[model samples]
Target chain A: MVEPVTIAVDVMGGDLGPDVVLDGALQALRADSALHLALVGPADVVEPFAAAHDRTRAVAATEVIAMGEHPAAAVRAKKDSSIVVGCRLVKEGQAQGFFSAGSTGACLAAATLVVGRVKGVKRPALGQVLPAYARPCLLIDVGANADCKPEYLVQFAQMGVVYMESIMGVSAPRVGLLNIGSEDTKGDEFAQKAHQLLAASVPQFAGNCEGGNLMAGDFDVVVCDGFTGNVCLKTIEGTAKTLFKYVKDALMASLPSKLGALLVKGDLSRLKGKLSPETYGGTPLLGVKGAVIVGHGSSNATAVANGIAVAATTVRANVAGVIADTVARAGSATPGGEGEAAASDAR
Target chain B: MVEPVTIAVDVMGGDLGPDVVLDGALQALRADSALHLALVGPADVVEPFAAAHDRTRAVAATEVIAMGEHPAAAVRAKKDSSIVVGCRLVKEGQAQGFFSAGSTGACLAAATLVVGRVKGVKRPALGQVLPAYARPCLLIDVGANADCKPEYLVQFAQMGVVYMESIMGVSAPRVGLLNIGSEDTKGDEFAQKAHQLLAASVPQFAGNCEGGNLMAGDFDVVVCDGFTGNVCLKTIEGTAKTLFKYVKDALMASLPSKLGALLVKGDLSRLKGKLSPETYGGTPLLGVKGAVIVGHGSSNATAVANGIAVAATTVRANVAGVIADTVARAGSATPGGEGEAAASDAR
Candidate 1:
């Protein structure tokens, strides 16, 4: 029999508070018999849910980090906060992974500081699976390092490949560097330097992928600096929401359109389900020592449950360890270390 | 009586070549009695169309700059290219503005190097009017300066204000710095520093605007470095296209859905029209001494006609002169000149 992977859930985090998180955790526990959850929050908040589930346990924490608080400072000061405590559980080997729909900054801070970075990894990246034309594409460094060096992108690409292959079940994922244009000479100095390094090193490198081509799903993995990636991600999200709203408004403008809307409502719902953030569960903070899944702050119960499932799956695949191994191998293959060489060249 | 505004149209440029451009130019001339076009291209290609319209005249240009060629090199080597000649018409006071549905880089290079930058303006920005929820918002520096100094953003805001107030007719346009977060301290060094400068100098500074809030039309002007703006613009384009395609596919999945689609065809057409790039005509290359408009290479007759109309409107408003005046006032108001001070501080 396979051993159950214990995943720590931050019940006190997220906009919905502990109640929604606890309910979601219970749902996740019921769905997977081989999964275990440690619901971390105030004793009174987590007890009822923990007592009802056979594979669930309660881990009490005293404080909660506000979404607007400075991440590192809050994590350092509030050692008993759900986010910090949950990450600590993973660090202590009590849990294989951590899941939170909390303050993204806080989760990133606690995960990097408490659970720690994988050995030989320069910077951890936030990898998100987005719906595209042909298949789902994984975008790395969505908001980890806004200012990035060329070597950092190289490592991001490696981590992305590992995650996509192991978790998403894609073989030899095609990697692309997101830029303003398809030409290698496009973009800023940083992008130019990164392109050269990626072309030289990353075997699956597909050259420059323009922003307009991202949803075409021509490549499996797209790497970009956190700033551009964040803008792109949010732009897509905003555009999708706005477009749907526009379409709905148009559909309801007249009787004929209203009847049409009623008839096609099911198909619309299916499209929405496919495009929903919950479908992808959460973005993984790859290259961390343990599995760290950060869900949308406005995530519902389904999203939370999906996030926990993602955490469990990532833990089972040992994504962090694989990333470390990949980085080490790449570093050894290049003389004087790829990171050092890129840094020197940049200087 | 108001005198006609003479505009130079690059008849040889664009994907469809001279025929489509001339057809569009003739249409613009027919629509507006107070508009005259100097059709700049090979004499043989433009003469037939030019002779057909009372307000149209042909100017001979011997060479054409390909879209894929390097901008600066091509402009230097092909001095008699249609793009260069069109801008030269504006420079020689033969035309009040120049329009091209050709290579963006070439137009930018020719406009900056030939027509020249307004006095005290450090960088000329590409300003695009995007349809937003409340109103059309102007996004500046879409792909001009990939690597930007904080002061350049300040100038961009000033230019945006001028364009919005003079052209878009927005009274005291609110300008927002585009960043990952809305916080004052959010984003990278450039964004944070630019936010500070903008807040200090720009009268209508609306603080930081996140990417998701862009389509909401909360701010009149959204400013960012060229790279992020380019990514955001293209991502929107790609996402919109993908979503529409998905909707179409869903509608065609079954007979019932197809019937519903037929009923709501008008509504769908309206939605598509609102989101179409052709609706905006072209993006104005702001801060150039003379009006220079760059349209999409795939522009149709309607889009080309709209581009010509936009050029005429901008020329009548004297956007470049107003921008120069605004910059001069801002520069004089600051003790050490905001640009120099910000540049030194950034260094």
Candidate 2:
């Protein structure tokens, strides 16, 4: 039999509080027989639950990081916070992975500083699976390095290819450079330089993919600077919500429409379930030395459970090790070790 | 009675060619008795239409700039092209404004190089009216000025304020700095600096606006660097299209759902209309010495007519003069003429 995978869960992280996280952790434990959980939180909050559950232990964390606190400073100062403790568990090899639905910035900071980065990796990026209409697409650097150089995007594409291939079973995943236009020289200076590097370095490089084509599933992976990708991701969410709300208001305006809404409600709900962020669970912080999933702040119990499963899956795939080896190989293949040079300057 | 307003229409522009633009120009003439049109295109295409319609005249142009051509090069090389000639009309004071359903890049280039930027304005920007669920919001720098400094964003907000005030009749329009987070110090260096400038300079600064709040109608004007703004605008369109397509497919899956779709078809169509880009006519290229509207390349005849009407309205409102005055005033007010120093470095 295979060894059981252990994941550290930060119970103090989301808007819904520890009760919801504890319930989700229990649900995940029940679903996976071989899964062990390290519940990280305040002593009183985690001790009783750990004692009552099998294959579980409580890791007491004395401090709590507020959502509004500065990320780097908070992670540095709040050494005993749940987020930091959870990362420490991964660093100490007590847990194979970590999951949290807390402040995304705080999670990123803790993961980068505490868990450390993979060897030769410049910067870890948040790679999220967007629910595209035709098929799911992975968008990298969603909000990690907002001010990115060309080489950073190349690394993001490489890491994304690895994750999609290993986890999503996408073979030779087609990659596209996200830009303002489809032309090779469409975006600003950074995009232009990135496009040239992507075409040269990435074997599966497709031409530029405009924002309108992001959800069309023309490319399996899309790489962009974190700022643009973040805006695009949020814009997609806002658009869907706004459109659906308008549709509901329109349906209620007439009797026939109201009747119609009832008849198609189930089908529409199913479609929504397919597109919901809860299905994806969380965004993986790729290039970190250990698996770390950043869940949405408003995630429910189901989403939290899904996030735990994702962390386990990521551990099983050995994503961090694969990334480290691949990046080292790529760096050696370059004429003058450009990748290492770039990583040296990384934050 | 007010004096007649004349707008130069690039009949050769757009996917459908001169036929749709000619028809729309004719329709606009019929709808408003005091509105005249200068149809700019090849002799064969515009001469007959102008001869057949009252208050319409054909302006012969020997060349046409295709969509895929480099914008700046095409505008310079094809000096007699319909797009260039249309801008030339505004430059020579033959027409009050220009409208085109052609290449956005070409339109932006011609407007900047030919019609020229307003004195003291660093860069002219494209400001599109977004069909927000609650109300319309103006998004500036949608595609122009791809690489923007914080000062350029300040100018964009100032220009947006003038356009929203004069055209949309918004009083003290609320301006927002588009960023990844809502916090004052959330985004990268550029966004943080832009937020500070916007808050200090804009009277109705609404702080940092996240992507999710874009269409919520909390802010009347949202300003971003051109690259991010373009991606956000296109992402919003893509998401709306993708979601509706999914809804339609879901509704067609079962017999009852199909019936429901039929019943709600009219109401849904109305909602779609309310969210459609065609309804917005065109995005105005703000901060130019003369008015220029960039219509969607896929614009139909009615959309073309709407664009022309928008350009005429922009001219009537003296938007160019208002922006020039506001920017000039803001520039002089700043210590040590910071605005002028920044404008000198603009491309």
Candidate 3:
């Protein structure tokens, strides 16, 4: 018997509007027998769908936070916004998790402020799975803390280790510090210090991994400050787009090549599907007290449903609880009794 | 008649050995009638070739700095090393420029210490062209200085502007700060301060460019701290390799796809040729007093020849002198009298 997991779905979020999210909600409900969804959006938008669905209900949210508005400001001002309402559901214990494909900033702000942070966790980081070769690698702090202390990275690594083990099903995740070179003395002051802390804290630390190894599937988890991680993630996205464009141009250049393109079109499309974010569902907001999955703003129906599934899986795995414990252990084990040690002491 | 250009080549520098560099030297000598080569290496490796070829001479250096050796230490310890000898040629005005496929760190160290810095330049940066869509974009400080001041970035932009205009023939190149976000307020303290300096110092500043925009060919020049720039460069390289592997796998999955792959093989090869680093030749050691072109360690004969051509072009354009003037002008135009302005004042 599977334990039932209820997740709040922000239908008013993604770029495709309510219809796509609603469609995805239905798909998710059909796929998971023990999954329940609280469709969060304007009353008129979600009311009918909730009434029709068996295990789903409507959660009224009056306002919508646009993608362009300021994240913290918009989140604060739009009290009845779907992102805020979805987070509130998790905080109120009405939903075990929250999923949104909205503005990342708004989602992050609402989740952090409303849902709160896990005990012993200094900062909640965004851990995203890079669609790498052979297997995917999880990159933490994709865009949470622009400036991170060494202790914060240690916390991130602890959370990442738990997330990878519980949700990703890896026996023991290999952690690598994202840096310019593999050597400990290779980068700026921040990197050198971070390297020392990570080596001391993470038992599975695989030294430093360069940017080129991010998609090489050599390590299970790669940790870096949000700024570097964000740039790295976006660079991969941009590079993929640019390369595919080049491939398309090459295939369309001559008559024989066009025939070749037609023949291999289906296989290439399937390859794209495997590498797409929709396949991974969403990025988990680790170190948060509740299960929060933030999808891409451009997510479609399949992606939304995948996000819900990921949220449910995260909820079932008790990722937040595990992260809390892991962080406590790491904090206690840290040398010099820094901020992280103080956090553990408070707990 | 074209003015003669003399470039000292580090014959024993690359992974492919002196034979490859000698072959490239011969090819370059044949291609450009006015081009002269001063092959710097062990006597046995370069002497016979130089004796046989017209407009070519051997400058023997007994020692060879291995790629794995510490950059500054090797340069300081081995006075008669090929890299040191090559730089000495340019310093003594025996050669207009220096070209090498040796260790980047060693090349940078020798160039900065021996060849010297252009007046008013605080730090000499390594700027490489990213093979982007439609055209290429110049990325400065790829791996020269791990940490950079705001004024250093301004200097990088100024040097980038001169390189793009003179070599790439991009009139009034658009400069962009490689940051996590497009917003001015986004990123850490370093980025924020750099943004302010770039906007004020560079008239052609295009605001902040995210990592995704790197290979989009949207901006002609993107500047960042050496740490960030190095990671960005390697990540792109890694992502390209990963994507191509996926493409290859997809093409080999089935019989139909295999046939398609066969048909498109030639066109794809040509496309790869256009995108390869060989096309760009080498990364210029910008801000240095003399022309220094650092080729890839794995560079073959063709790549070596291309590097020599780029060095010849750099010497002809007097890129270092232009950068000096540009830096002085920018320093004078700056709002506050910082280190850059102090440099200009000293000049």
Candidate 4:
């Protein structure tokens, strides 16, 4: 049998530390046969997992940045920090990619600063897959770059298009710019200018999309600046949390409603399955030199495995290469090219 | 007792028409003693409600607007349209204000064209009270003017602040520009230009606010163009709907979780009360000469009652007058007041 590809795991990442991180990594290993792991963190953090299960599945790359430390400072000071060490393994070619459930800020800093950007990417973006009605719609720049030029969004659109196609198997995904309305003049100054820039510079735009259409699956890929996308994503998450309480209260307030809720429970679960943040467990930091999947900090065992699988799938799909290749082909539409893409979208 | 002020209600509005509208009107009368409703529609629609309920509290202002008719075109064409008839009552001092659960486009058109804007008010805005952990937060220009000028957002800030202080009882509500980020220079051209104008003109802007802080209770009044606000509002609504499904599935996943849900059901309901769309039911179309509360077409009786209460509260608190007075005092700032607020921010 061929030797399995080793993936680097940021063992010190996440709020619950090694317990949740270790639980997730172990579960991930069980789910995938061809994957081995380089678990990077303090010895104490990595040793317990090594003692419990198959030591053959993971090798410790010990040391870590404290959760409270500045991400950039930590990366510089803590040379062996879990996030740094994990990304370093990929940089050194010992591992294909890395997965982390830690400080999104620090993780992003290390990923770009260490692993670098793809060949012609103008700016890297944190691309997320939202579980909409028809299929998972990918929204890029969830919270990486706050300031976005029209050209940056165009680059993000191209990169997001490639990631969705290669990793998710979506072909010729319709690209849409997230805006207040679908009309050309309906957005802020940037959107209006971006519309002009996109139509003239980029060929993939499916036109403008409203926020209400997120669930309606209006397009395959939704492109926006990180600030707007992050706000949109988190606002949705907050609203979902808020609405869950309301619907439950409505159902339980009366006997008839409760009975109806019970009858429809299976349908409800199926609907939930279609929308769970866990089903698509990780958001890929696209346009990076290497694959970096940012898993939810609150993720459990199943989610962690899913995140690792996502990173591996991205690596396997050669997403970064395709992204670099696509932008290179796009040419002058992207002026700064790979160098601009590498640094502009960092935390 | 002195006669209650009449509120002209459009019975022909909304998907359910007179039945739900009448139900909501009756609910409103029962909840508030000062409510005198002038229910407007054809005799067929209003006569039934008058027959079943005490006519002393409700009067039929007979007229009807066809659903498919154009709002502005219909208001001018169909002089007998209920929405127009209702606005006429407010114009003639037969009613203090108006409320409609009809076509949003129709309601705003009727209110603006019929009642008109306050003197020197170049633009009017729809200010919505978004439920928050603290008192409800106000966001102006939800969908009033699709296109916004920098001067218009500044005007909205002044009006939104008055609405918050008067109706929500927030004293000196921290006003903020809803931008992609907190930086003064961040966001699109309009936002950047508006930042300069707001700093120059408006008095209480707390500085630039990122989209993520919309719920964090940082600003009492968050101002953005209609397009961005609509997108942000819809995104929040969509996300809430999505999360609502996830929680239901989690609670019903197994027997123990279901049992746990039982104990926590009351707490869940209380939480729902804070987040429900009904808590802050109506959005006041600010800058109008008279009070006008626009309830959503999907609103239930509770939401309708809350809308009535909100209109009554704004009028009662003299919200519009406060805005008129504030602008008068700050009128000496400059032609556009673009640099006045900026000078203050610089301090």
Candidate 5:
């Protein structure tokens, strides 16, 4: 008899609001018998789910954070907000993980402030597992710290390595620093310094990986500052969407192409599935004390359910604890290990 | 009849070297009777083209800059190099423009140092005309100034607008500041400051554009620092290639899908053409005293021809003189215009 992994779900988040969130939570609960969910929202919104499932619990909250509101300010003001309360549940040890398809800024804020950072971790990076040609690769700091130092990237690499090893079950993950070019001398002062730091610190440091080779599947983990990473991720998504739209428009331009499109409909659907963010479920905010999964703001029911599953799996794997250990090991391996330890302690 | 526009071609540049360059130069000369080409390279490589075409002239250059050589060092050391000599021809009024399908770094260095910068222009930006949903958009600073200040971005926007309006024939082009978020307060310190400067200076400023909206055709000109713009451009190219590869694999997986692919071959070719970098030919190095066009290193004969035609069109339109005038007007339009002019004079 294994104990069920409990996860807190923010029902009042995302663009779709509570109804879609509640439905997704219910679907997730039904799919896994060893899974438990604490649906946090207004009483009316969450009470129905709590009453229906034996493994589900309702945690009432009155306030909701708007997507456009300043994240830190909103989190600070709305203590009873669904996002904040859900994270608080994880902080209190009532849940092993927290899941939200909400305002990304709000989720990041609450997760870092409420659930807290793992010991010795300077910043928590938002990581996404994206499908590449050969296999899936993890990209860290998709939108966490936009202005990052070389030391911060080193930490991001360590966290990414640990997450890939423990959660994705990859041994000795190859870490690549994302830069403008593959050469060591490429990029600006920050990227140059970061490359040197990563080369000295990380065990499986593969040199620089250009943005063009990101989907080539040559790297297991790619580390970059949030600004560049965010642009890279969104560019991929946008270009994919635009390309498909262009193809569809081209196909429907004439009768022969329309017939061709009909024949390959199944293949196209499969291709879409491979490229869809929902297939990967949710992105994990690593280096936090508790497992935190942030889904797309426009995620559907399937995506939300998958996000919950990811949260449960991450919690079961104890990713937070593993990340802490990995960062500590990486710190001790460097010549300035003692200084790094002292700085972390001071923080 | 209008007087013929003379442009310099780096006959020894690109992967295919002199053969493809000479062939493409001949094709351009044949296509446009009013175009004259100065083929600059070793006598053995360029003399044949000069002898074959009445309008083509051969200029002897003894040295070639390899793609891997350090850009500044190569430009300084190889005084008789084809790229340096080509730019020198343009600088000395023998040619109105210079074109190369060779090392981008070398081209940039030679163009900046030899061709010179427009008066009052701080830095030259590399601008590429990429296809969007509705029309083509000009992306500036693709690889010119990697680490750019906010003022540099403002200049880029001004240059991008002028290029799009005069060359692409867009009236009052909408300028967009490329950032991770659409909000004014949503980027790093650099982006935030650049946004403010652009909003105040650019007449058709469209506010901040997220990476995802880059291909949506919502803006006519998108501006970013060289690093982010380079990454964004490469990411798009890489993603498009990967997606097409994925689609081809999916189509060939089964007989029926393969048949469907055959039926849509024409449509597929059209889609590929729409996404091909070759369709746009070359990226113009804006802000230089003379027009300088940089083509892809892997350019085929047809692509090379298109690049030469682009150079001819840019020269005919007097893009460099117009850019200088636009910058002078923009500098004076701002309150600190006198100080900027003083700084330029000092430089």
Candidate 6:
């Protein structure tokens, strides 16, 4: 085994606070002995759960981030809050990465403002790696920055390709722009411009993948503006839920269906595994200084464990450094190089 | 059963020409005795399909509309083209409606330019019913007009609810503005203004439904600017395909999984039936003065058949006349009320 990679966990995040978070962290550590964590939250909140099991030197604590407050304000105001403090540890190099099931907007802000944007990175995209046939395909900008320029999308494509190749071990991943139709003349000015920039600038252009091809798994990485990506991601989630509901209703609608359901229960769970976002666990906030894994709001122990695993994997892969270098190269021809060039200023 | 609605079909308008269209029209006619069709196509090309099948007396003929040519250019040049000819029949009351499994853009232009927009409708919108658990949720302005003001979305919401209530017979249909989040402040300028406008203007303002809720059976109808709506609609299509691929892959991953798939095949097919866009088949161009249905380019016999069925249903429901009357009422409140003045002005 390699050196144990330490992660900072937000014990006060989610509907089930310290109990679930502590339990999940402990479970994760058990599953992967190389895992170590800094459980950030109120000492009193985390103490009971920590004491219930053997209090190992491997675990640490800070303070909790409240759920009720505004994300941008809370991260700045309560620097000692679990999510904030936890993120700070990674920033200071005390922890290899940070994992939080807290408010997504807060996590995004803290990571960008505190961890900082990597050099030449225009936008810190939130990349969701969903299950694809054989290997997973990365869908970038799920709900990060809503408005994006063509260059940002190009960078996202490059960043995404790098993540898939380095982290997922998929070489020469086919990158596609998400659009209404697969035709060249489709989409708005931004989509059209992004297509031009990507085809001209990026090395691997998988042509254009229509929304239908996205689910068909014709490409390895699907890139789009945060707004479209978020919409696409959420629509998939909605459709899946609708499909599942219909399946349930159908099974209960008839006696034969009930028998079939019982017989196929195990298979159904496995099928669910294929569809579960938790199976992939966390999303990496790309183009940040330090590793940050964002888990789903309703994420359970397995997903939480996987989130820590992903963070560890990302650290080992040195994703941030690679992203910085990639961005540096891509923007070298343009004005202020990659570093110190304001992201908003570039577009 | 319901006074079989007579619909005029542009048989030669689709990509596959009259062969698939002929197969589909025959199926629909056989299935419904009340339906009569004006089959418009190249008389020469259509004869073979007409000869092969036991011909129905309801089928009439018009000349051809090529698939590869510019939609508007082709229609304009070939005034006797199948699509134009079919709509002309409806215009002259030869057939009560028109359906084309052809170029969507062409059909839209034809409806607006030829048949004309319904009186007082701001813009002619496309209403495509997406599969949901309860039934299907209607999404307006899927790709009709790329750029739209807030008022367009408002009108779409109003008209879409009426379309569902009167035609699909959903009473007090929940109208949702397509938005990024449920929060009032979560969208672009158009969506923001639309949120406020819808709240005051529409009686059953169901607040907002995010992309994920589009097919979650949360709302009966969803409204948005054409640009965003098109993007969102495509996103839904793409995400669903991605999920479909994942599920199929999981089922075929190994022998055990394959065995599970065999056992649950029935349930799986049923799930697919519930979500497949093919089940809904054709999308109706909602604000036309006469009925005009546009099916998918890749539509096979089922979709084409459904397109015919939709055309028949739409005419029976008198969707355009209802919208025209509704728009007249809505328009008369503020203006000189030359019928369709605002609609004509908006266009």
Cα lDDT tens digits for candidate 6, A264-297: 5566678877678888868889988778988887
Ranking by lDDT: 3, 2, 1, 5, 6, 4
Q: Per-residue lDDT tens digits of candidate 3, residues A1-347? A: 78899999999989998999999998999999999999999999899988988999999999999988889999899999999999999999999999999988888899889999998787899999988899879999898877666667878888888888988888888999988887778776667777888888789898898998999999999998888889889999999889888999999999999999998988998888887777788889998877999999889999999999999999999999988877777677886425533211110
* lDDT tens digits, residue span A23-107, model 1: 7887798788999999999999888777876988999999999999999999999999999999999999999999999998899
Tell me the TM-score that candidate 6 gets on chain A alone.
0.90
Give me the candidate number with maximum DockQ. Answer: 1
lDDT (10s digit) by residue, model 4, range A49-160: 6676663334455566655566677787767678888888899998888999887768888988899888766568898899775577998888777556656888888888
Docking class of 2: medium
Q: Which candidate is the best by lDDT?
A: 3
Q: What lDDT is reached at residue B202 by model 6?
A: 72
Compare candidates 3 and 5 on lDDT and give the better one.
Answer: 3
Q: Tell me how far the alpha carbon of residue A344 in candidate 3 is from the true structure, in angstroms, after superposition.
A: 24
TM-score of chain B of each: 0.96, 0.96, 0.96, 0.89, 0.95, 0.88
Residue range A1-347, candidate 5, lDDT tens digits: 55589999999877887788888887898889999999999999788779977889999999999889999999999999999999999999999999999888899999999999999888899999987787888999899887666678888898898888877888989999988888898986667777888899888899998888888888899998888889889888988999899988888878888888888778987999889987888899999987899999888888899999989888888889888888887777754433432221110
Alpha-carbon shift of residue B190 in model 5 (angstroms)? 0.6
lDDT tens per residue, model 4, B111-172:
78888777657677888788654456787788777556667788899899888878777888
Candidate 5 clashing pairs, residues 3+ apart or interchain: none
Model 3 lDDT tens row, B102-198: 9999999999999999988888999999999988899998999986666788889989989999999999799999888888888776688788888
Candidate 1 per-residue lDDT, tens place, B10-123, comes to 987789877788778878988899999999999888787678768788899999999999999999999999999999999999999999999999999999999999998988
Give the share of true interchain contacts found in each model: 0.68, 0.68, 0.78, 0.24, 0.62, 0.45
Candidate 5 residue runs with Cα over 4 Å from true position:
A1-3, A335-347, B335-347
Off by over 4 Å in 2: A1-3, A334-347, B335-347
Model 2 lDDT per residue over A103-152, tens place: 89999999999999998888899998998877778999899987776788
Worst 10-residue stretch by lDDT in candidate 4 chain A? Answer: A338-347
C-alpha local distance difference test of each model: 0.87, 0.87, 0.88, 0.73, 0.86, 0.74
